[model samples]
Target: MHYVTSKTLLSSNNGMNLYRGCTHGCIYCDSRSECYNMNHDFEDIEVKQNSAELLKKELLKRPKSMVGTGSMTDPYIPIEKNLKYVRKSLEMIYRYGFGFTCITKSDLVLRDLDLLEKINERSKAVVQMTLTTADDDLCSILEPNVCVTSRRVEVLKTLSEAGIPTVVWLCPILPYINDSHENINGILDFCIESGVHGIICFGMGLTLREGNREYFYKKLDENFPGLREKYVEKFGDSYTVSSPNNRELMKIFKKRTDEKGILNDNDEIFRYLHNFPQDSVQTKLI
Candidate 1:
């Protein structure tokens, strides 16, 4: 909800965050980790006033690469409906002949379908959506501030029908909450039906750190009631906090994705994302 001028945009690897912090209110958000120092409140949403101009300048100077966003914050948050920074950035990427990709939980991405399709037709554009649980009720609890799982699946289907490739982040499966065979199967089924090109799952468990860990535990106490004590007894200041069902859940994940020909490997997906197609006609203009 605040604006500040940004000196630069785009990282060495061609990523940019148009906004710092987030309003998504996802209970397991890692961006809140103390490792990433944010001077503002998590929900305040610091807008980079000069992001569009800065991105245009950087795009002109850099080699054609896949430009990405929504790493630290969801670019399609509610504020995006009015700010429209993400849409502006997409236009610049398309105009510059750069491939585009982003990680988001909002269905509002559909609003920029025209630009995304144009960029994909010229080069490449991948829409990466996160689907943690198939149950809409659980999704509401875990990612309270964004769209539900079924609606996101619909967005994926719409994008696929438009001939745009899509990817899904199936991650941070909380133990004793969503780490069930039924829950995992439901989510995987949704991915397969949506025609997602890949699923990035680190494991069946979520990670906890200083800032995020405290916030997650607080929410657990409020919602799950005494789940915090169980986490302490089980993890007790550990970083990874992997699920006991990780092995079995991963078995199911790999088998399903492999059968469906959807990628289950993180490195493979990363390569797919970072590899910018050089066939773009716009590349010649630049």
Candidate 2:
């Protein structure tokens, strides 16, 4: 909830984060890792007060491309209800004739459905949502601050109905916790039913670095009792924590997504996301 004047908005890759840090109390947030090096508390939320203006300048200078956000933090956190920086930035992106994409887990995205649809019509607008667990109660524990999985599915359906392509991030499977076929199948079923364009799942595992590792372990100790000790015994300090069922679960993920004609390959989905349609550029020129 703090604002600071920022020098720039978009990265060389055309990605922009309207806010830094997050309020979404996800126990397994990799952004909390020390490698990112945020100066303030994770919940403090650094705001780029002049992001809209900076984005306008950047967009006017560059050719039409897909501008993405919410990689480092969710732009639709509760603070967004009052700040509305994301909404303002969307207006700027649309006004400048650039494509837009975002990764979010909150139903708050529904509030901006009008603008997303408009951008899709003019260029392209893809909504990428992360669905870690299908169980609502488990979802609440894993991602405490955002909307549940079912609600996120509804948001995806609504976006699809609006003609906006949707992508799902099925990740951080939290080995030994949600690495079950039932959870994977449940989430994939939701994706198929919602008609998602793709699903990105690296594997049935979660990574833990220094900062996030401590936080995750602490949460496990608090909630799951002896689970922290079990993790320590199994994976002393390894960064990548893959599940025993990673191979099997991946098979299910690939089979389901492939059968439904949904994009499951990470590279393909990223290429699709970063690609700016030629028609959009042509329309901009016209």
Error of 1 at 121 (Å): 0.4
Worst 10 residues of 1 by lDDT: 277-286
**Window of ten residues with lowest summed lDDT in model 2:** 277-286
lDDT of 1 by residue, 35-79 (tens): 898988999989999998899888889888899985789889899
> What is the lDDT for 70 in model 1?
51
Candidate 2 collision pairs: none
Clashing pairs in 1: none
Note the clash tally of each candidate.
Answer: 0, 0
Supply candidate 1's per-residue lDDT for 281.
74
Model 1: how far residue 267 lies from native, Å: 0.3
lDDT of 2 by residue, 1-286 (tens): 6989999888999989989999899999999999998989999989998987898788889988999995889989898888899999898888878889999999999999999998998889999999998899999999988899999999999999999999999988987899999999999999999999999988899999989999999999877889999999998899999998999999999888888899988999999999998776433432
